[model samples]
Every structure is written in C-alpha cells, then in structure tokens.
Target: MVIILESLLGSMFEALLDYSEGFILRQEVGGVG
Candidate 1:
C-alpha cells in the first residue's frame, strides 16, 4: 500500500513538473512553442 501511494505521488509530481516546465518554456519563447 505504501509503495502504491509513493508511486502515485511520484507520478503526480512528475506531471506537475512537466506542466511547470511547459509554462516556463512558453514564457521564454513568447509562445507555446
């Protein structure tokens, strides 16, 4: 159970990071390139 929760948390964190990275990248490029 703990392992499953940890895995899910990791995935959620990764998705959040990807979203943040995309947002920054868009800002730097002046568009969502």
Candidate 2:
C-alpha cells in the first residue's frame, strides 16, 4: 500500500515536471516555426 502511493505520487510529480518542460519546448518551437 505504501509503495503504491509513493509510486503514484512520483508519477504525478514527474508528469507535472514534464508538462512544464513541454510547455517551454512548445514556446521555443513556436518561435522557430
């Protein structure tokens, strides 16, 4: 149970981090486009 929660939280945090990074990448790509 504890492990499951920890993994879930980790994935959620990773997704948020990826989202922010992707948003920045989109902006950079937009400028290049």
Candidate 3:
C-alpha cells in the first residue's frame, strides 16, 4: 500500500533525475560542437 507507492515514487524520481542529467549533458555537447 503506502510502502509500495513510496518505492514507486522513489524509483520514478531517480529515473527522472538521471534523464535530466543526460539531457543537460547532451545539450552542452551540442552547444559546444
């Protein structure tokens, strides 16, 4: 119930963070190149 929801939210947040970091890195590389 609550535990499951918390785990799901945590994983989603982590994934979003990773995606954002990757996106930023790509944007910087594209801007430089």
The prediction achieving the highest lDDT against the true structure is: 1
Q: How well does model 1 score by local distance difference test?
A: 0.96
TM-score of 1: 0.80
Q: Candidates sorted by lDDT, descending order?
A: 1, 3, 2
Model 1 lDDT tens row, 1-33: 999999999999999999999999999999956
At residue 25, candidate 2 shows an lDDT of 91
Candidate 2, 1-33: lDDT as tens digits: 999999999999999999999889989899563
TM-score of each: 0.80, 0.65, 0.89
Query: Model 2 compared with the native: what TM-score?
Result: 0.65
Error of 1 at 3 (Å): 0.4
The local distance difference test score of each candidate is 0.96, 0.92, 0.93
Best by TM-score: 3
Which residue segments of model 2 deviate by more than 4 Å? Answer: 28-33
